[model samples]
Target: MNEIFVKSLPLKDVIANIAEALDTTYFNRCNEYILNIPEIYGEGSIRGINFLNGFGLIEYNCTLKEALKIHFNVNSIHPLKFIYCSKGSVKHKFEEHDVLHQIEQFQNIIVASTQQNGHILIFPKNENIHLNSLEISRKEFKTKIDCDLNILDVGLKKLFKDLTARNLFFYQGNYSLAMSDCIDTIKTSKFSGIARSLFLEGKSNEILSIQISDYEDDKKDIPKRQILRKSELVQIQKAVQILKSELSKPLTIKELANKVGTNPTKLQEGFRYNFGLTVNNYLNKIRLDYAKEQIMIGELNISEIANNIGIANKSYFSRLFKATFQLNPKEFSLQIAKNANKRQRNRPLT
Candidate 1:
């Protein structure tokens, strides 16, 4: 495996050190340090930027030609790290430890080395790995104005205030939806220069807040913890596909759960958390939407449309359509026809 060592701090120097180790070079964009992967090795780039509040953001978006390990062995205390894997997987290990922890996609790990013990990150070759690291320089962060009382939990407060790095902390869990949204925003952002830097700085902090909250919620009892996982997301996708494909014969929540290889309760939770509605409601939406499409075609009558979408009673289907769209199926169809006629009448000399 190829190895690169970063022996620096404040993020910018960290990227510079990696560039030197690679025998390559890096560039600066609004104080954001970026090191593009050399063409001889692979494709993509890795970049880092430091904020004034002692928080830093680093993103690795690349597909290397071979396995690689980045060894961070700074002389001083290493910054607390919140590493998130958004695309491919990566492995983590403390420089002084022997055990390695694999962080897969959609997962995160909160780590604090024991008393200057550094960190080693391993990335597999020929994989599209996109990950971000949110680092906090505790020595500087503790002195920032935003690090006030009531901003953190008792243990987290202690963790932040521990400038000596006497304790070793390692936590791994699935990242929250809110954190995912923040990251999505960061990736899709179109800004550049100072605008981009300021925007990312704020979003990075927002992601950190959500990450800490996610950690706190994870510490609670199993029943009270609502953290979503990759398994649930897979189930949700399966459920959606079944609903859309078998529209004329929709299944009950329990039946759908069985079809998707999950329990009814988990299915319901997945629908609510991912789609913002219950399973039954989502099914109804699918049916109603299909009904509208059939209605617009002007081939199926109300009863036929209702039956085509798995609804036996036309009256009940009409009522549902009215409740959701403020217009009964018949009325909506009529409105569609009227708009079509008006447009035809207004047609020009063609």
Candidate 2:
């Protein structure tokens, strides 16, 4: 029954206050703050980088030692939240729904321009979690950009029409690779100081843009595909899990479809409708993401990384890696090594 109250403040302050409540000191450099919880509190940590004008990125990767609830009060103007649960789950209830809404792994949820006093989030104990959240203050958005709001998707337009509304508009769906890439860039970028702040700001804006574009695409695709039955949705989700777990195996779409108890056409259509990617495209995206992660670990050579991800042709793997990340595998590996070395040199003597 542990509870934490978070007042509406800039994201950096929010993070700082949480660390204080947990009796931990946060490492501060430039506008970024990183908190590592001790074993008594939890395992893992929280990292956040904020822009003074009100946009910020907060990343949480932790396992709570006990169940905890968070109450967040939105005191800022035109507050918006874009949240993705890359691992584990969290639950919350909106004003309109009596039932709790769960954001599970590989899913995303967005809250737009809510005027509600606050919302509650619950985290279960001993569950490993990874969450990335982007917060935007509409005032900051307006001051930073000169573009017309009408250029955005209709869904976003309606969300912004009445900034004073007590009820918030919500959007939830499968997290897209495009959105994932933006977050990966923000997390792995080697920049520091002002350069790091600027990199995060650019990445945050890029994520917002991708969300809008994805919303528009979903709107168009909704009409074309028939509504999926709950059972079908379950099967498609199972397929996704299988695909992720079996990255090292070369499984054709037909094989995946059969394994998931669906046909090729339904499988392909279901993937596009539910996840916004073709089977091949989604597979490739996950493969490249895995390869990138391995490269970042700095424990494997480029060929080893490629082979571990099921790519037989190292040259082809490099091509796909470059296409997705805009950097060749070797170059990306070198960058990760350079960053690790810099951090090592900067560490203070114990």
Candidate 3:
């Protein structure tokens, strides 16, 4: 196994360490540590990790087969937390006492100051382990969540992931040493009571938001898989049935969330989680399917189909039908007609 480990003790000491690590021949060279890794590792593949601590981001693009650990001394004064993921499919064996729920594929894992005490195990694409670390300061985080959490909650995970995914976005914009200093500060001190509470609250709210967003995305994007919790599935089943029976009118997201006994965010999330599609996407799919069935009966035109299906826009409906089935509404109707004709022709000679 080939291993290269490097550490920087302080702002000034960083240079000496780098110099010492590289001898005279390999010296007179300039080297810097990237805050995130942007490549994947495997046979015939180039994998690397990068972190942009100054920009509050981390990313990895390699695989590992054993348990790996990185312990850092964060100044208690400024704590940091981030979402981490493997580039390709990777299994994580989080310590027994840590995870509140099971972690699965496409699952967003939170690495906060408190939950940072554990080993991260990865199933590698090759016979090696590669890791990267990103740093964010508690004070910088406070600025992000100082206001009410309602807005930031909607896309916390996305923001965190995006930060790591786009290294240039963070490192290219004056975030190099500034972020490093912030991280160094956190490694050595503690925070006051008020700041600590605010920080914890921010982390909790962000995590909740991340889960909610995933749930919503799933409901809209997924169709064949059952992914929601038992309770959420029960709620979605009820909502779907009710919506089907009341096809003449569409149910608003808030209404569906309320009827399903969940908040709008939760209801949407539950719908996504259970169906792998967002609530709106699933609802539209149901509406379109119903419309197609009605069209087979030859009782409605495009306008009627839209109205009956509770779609607001006739033009939009046509486009959506084409998009969904790769055929225009008229074409689809004619195909159905041809099928019916063929079936009639093949019917028993009675």
Candidate 2 clashes between residue pairs 3 or more apart in a chain or in different chains: none
* Cα TM-score of candidate 3: 0.35
lDDT of 3 by residue, 5-121 (tens): 223122122223322332211121112222222132122211112112222222243343332232233233212334333223444333334433333322344343232233233
Estimate candidate 1's alpha-carbon lDDT, on a 0 to 1 scale. Answer: 0.86
> What residue runs in model 1 are displaced by over 4 Å at the alpha carbon?
145-155, 227-231, 241-280, 290-314, 322-350
lDDT of 3: 0.45
In model 3, the worst 10-residue window by lDDT is 167-176
lDDT of 1 by residue, 1-350 (tens): 99988864778888998788777999999999999989877899999999986789999999999899998886688889999998999999998899999999999999989776889999999999999999888788877734374577767777887788888888999886677778889889999999999998889889888898888877877555665555358878989999999888988887887788766766777888888999889999989888888888998888888887888988899899999889999899999999999999999975
At residue 267, give the lDDT of candidate 3.
64
**What is the lDDT, from 0 to 100, of the residue 84 in candidate 2?**
80
Identify the leading candidate in terms of TM-score: 1
Return the clash pairs for model 1, or none.
none
RMSD of each: 4.6, 14.4, 14.8
Evaluate all candidate structures by whole-model CA lDDT and list the values in order. 0.86, 0.75, 0.45
Report the lDDT tens digits of candidate 2 across residue range 1-350.
67887654576777787787788888887878888877897899888877756678888889998987877666755367788876899986553456687988767777753565556678889999888778766666555543667786777776655446555678877655567667667657899888887887788778777766656655655434333322356788888899889887857998987898766766887788776899989989999988988888778888887777788898999899999999999888888889999999999999
RMSD of candidate 3 to true structure, Å: 14.8
